[model samples]
Target: MSTRPILALISGANRGIGLAIATGLARQGAHVLVGCRDLSKGETACKALRAEGLQVRPVELDTTSTASVTRLAERIQQSYGYLDSLVNNAGIGVDDDPTLTTADRLQRTMSVNVLGPILLTDAMVPLLEASGRGRIVNVSSELASFGLRADPDWAFADFAMPIYQASKAALNSLTLSYARQLRDKGIKVNSICPGYTATEATNYAGNRTPDQAAVVAIRYALLNGDGPTGTFANDHGELPW
Candidate 1:
């Protein structure tokens, strides 16, 4: 709270957009914690960042497991006493085929993409409240934009990966709900639509790089007290809910 460096955590930071976000936040003088399901992978990522003379540490985290989320909250509570920012970046859409998706596949996708963040955010709220400057950034996608998808002229209009899109839409809803609820506590909660980026998740087909897509998330992570909350935006500007 004083002259100490900002303490931030970014989930799924082992690679791709999450890794880019961690690196970006670190460069901005924040002591970042890279959260990854694979400890070895996270260690590798952090090692690379540390080599750049950045303040970064790796933490083992599996977003889908309540035990994992709880453990992380506890560890941060003990080690840092408080957290300045929480970035929920772990997501997956393995079941992209809306028509042929089974209940199991839908459940798996939702568990990681929606339920995981909800659980983690709820767990981190206490630590964030301790910070007095808590911020939560939900990594979302424009594909979740009901407004854009409804437009006939929108690109990718004909494509609908129900499992993935629905999960992000649900995440957007969580952003609004959490922002309003945490307003009195002064915690800024908002959603960031990191555009389609060239990542393993996209099979490297997107036009932007992970670093390009990570800028908006870094911006929201470092928002001021007057910054917008309970809203959705991207690198360019606000997007329709």
Candidate 2:
């Protein structure tokens, strides 16, 4: 086995912030696992990373699918037996009639954004515990900020994508709860607001690049054993709860 001290798994890593984080970690001598829904896209990403001489492996993981998540867990257990970091980066933003958002949309968004991560983390907790210094990075957003929701000047408040916003809020709450539960287990769990990253989900309206956002995620992923947990931060600073 290579003597690399880090092993990282990032979901939805075929492109955007997830891809950027995988590349960054791989460059830092970590064995990066690129978890994607599309096997072709995963292979393409893996080839690109390998071309750059980064240790990257592609793993199929559709976060919304329970079967996929279970298979992913099994594969990781058999392949590495431990996980140093897990970056929950998979999410979806369905554009339906804001006022008439159906229950299906709400369920879908919540499944992928909230329940999916919870299940994945639960499945991987054992592997993380095996690593003894594991870290969990939940890729949250500023829109999830309850404080921002209360403020009229928060810019995104008027945006009526309640399903997406609420899903992320639930994700942030899950992060805190999981962090508290894992605090004594030598694992650190934290949430990050990527600050309007220019990804497909945002229609590129975001000012910050995916690579820039990846930096913050990577920092949280590589934190020391005593680092802060159950917190939300961005490139600017820590966001108010």
Candidate 3:
């Protein structure tokens, strides 16, 4: 009804899956806000997107920083007054090695992966509520699937990154909680795994490309009034919680 185009904010969108999602949404006529902690990188991404005649702008955001998160909320509220979509694409995963116990490593990992998205989503709820219909897509991992991990024969059952896995599980739970909280308000929130994409996080070991992985997130983000919420799914279908 607003005719302002679908306004979307994607964090950590400078590169990888985040950038791909931004591009996909923009190509579909959404005015995207590329949220990046590194302003230069954000600008670089936006420049490329702009060249493609896509509607997108770079916004300074660092999910781990309370000030940055709060500032982004304020900026969006003041600028657009409503946010139609939000993609919590900014996340970090560290090696599960003997160096994990350091105070710095533990706190930083959790702060980026878990606490950051939680705070960012909480801060942006008002903007999301302003939209008649809002969609929230949390970029979670299939690795967080407890149902799959419990099975000895699951493909990734042998893989282990305890802290990262736990953080994503927590993320999936929060996505459901937020979905329920905002259900009546018409804000759909869902957890989506981009599959094992070849990004910097995986050191390019993954078989899937960022563009290939962006499909499901784009689908979830652009769902209409009757789409499902509180779901954990991927390109395939609903994943076991």
Candidate 4:
């Protein structure tokens, strides 16, 4: 086994599903980096985990900003030298308005959900490669799956937010691209839908708790070198594209 301590960065980790994912990794002995747009909230989140005696720290990161994403990579490179895992858990849901224009919604959703992860991963992949056993977990959603959406009987059929859904589909595509490109370097990249979990994003209305939603994502992060890559899955198993 690699002797180097595992270092994992989870973006938007100040609360909700991101916090849950970060907490789960910390519990497993990974040095968790909580990435948040808000400094105070990030610190607060990390402090809570630290109180639990988990190796956790806060890193200010606005995934949509190039400068911010660059700073994140610089800080990690300077502090830990390399990254073992990167969970792109930062996302937004602003396309729910019935009157929202498609272009406007797509621009906003893609900025954080699609473009941000792409840039961050591109910048961080070198560090992950240095670890020799790298993992990139993209926090996607079932709404992104075209197959599921095509079914009129699908449970979430009524929840139509095209921008957010399309953004995740783009994210899933990026996951596969990264998995293929980094396969020879021993990096695993996969997208996962945590299901409809109760979090600030969902106003905590869903039946699933954040911890429950984070389970599969944590599992993917801890995968061995031999584990499958380029997969889109959830708690149960593989999901339709």
lDDT scores of the candidates, listed in order: 0.92, 0.90, 0.91, 0.91
Q: After superposition, how far is residue 91 of candidate 3 from its true place, in Å?
A: 0.5
Alpha carbon lDDT at 76, candidate 3: 92
lDDT of 2: 0.90
Off by over 4 Å in 1: 97-101
Per-residue CA lDDT of model 2 for 174-230, tens digit only, reads 999999999888889999988888988888878989899899999999998668999
Q: How accurate is candidate 1 locally (lDDT)?
A: 0.92
Per-candidate clashes, comma-separated: 0, 0, 0, 0
Q: Write the per-residue lDDT of candidate 3 for residues 31-66, one digit (tens) a residue.
A: 999999899999988997899899999999999889
> Model 1: number of clashes?
0
Q: What are the per-residue Cα lDDT tens digits for candidate 1 across 125-206?
A: 9988999999999999889999999999999798868888898999999999999999998899999989989999989998
Q: Candidate 3: minimum summed lDDT over ten consecutive residues — where?
A: 95-104
Could you give the C-alpha RMSD of every candidate to the true structure, in order shown? 1.7, 2.1, 1.3, 1.5
Error of 1 at 133 (Å): 0.9
- What would you estimate as the lDDT of candidate 3? 0.91
Pairs clashing within candidate 3: none
Question: What TM-score does structure 4 among the candidates reach?
Answer: 0.96
Clash pairs for candidate 4: none
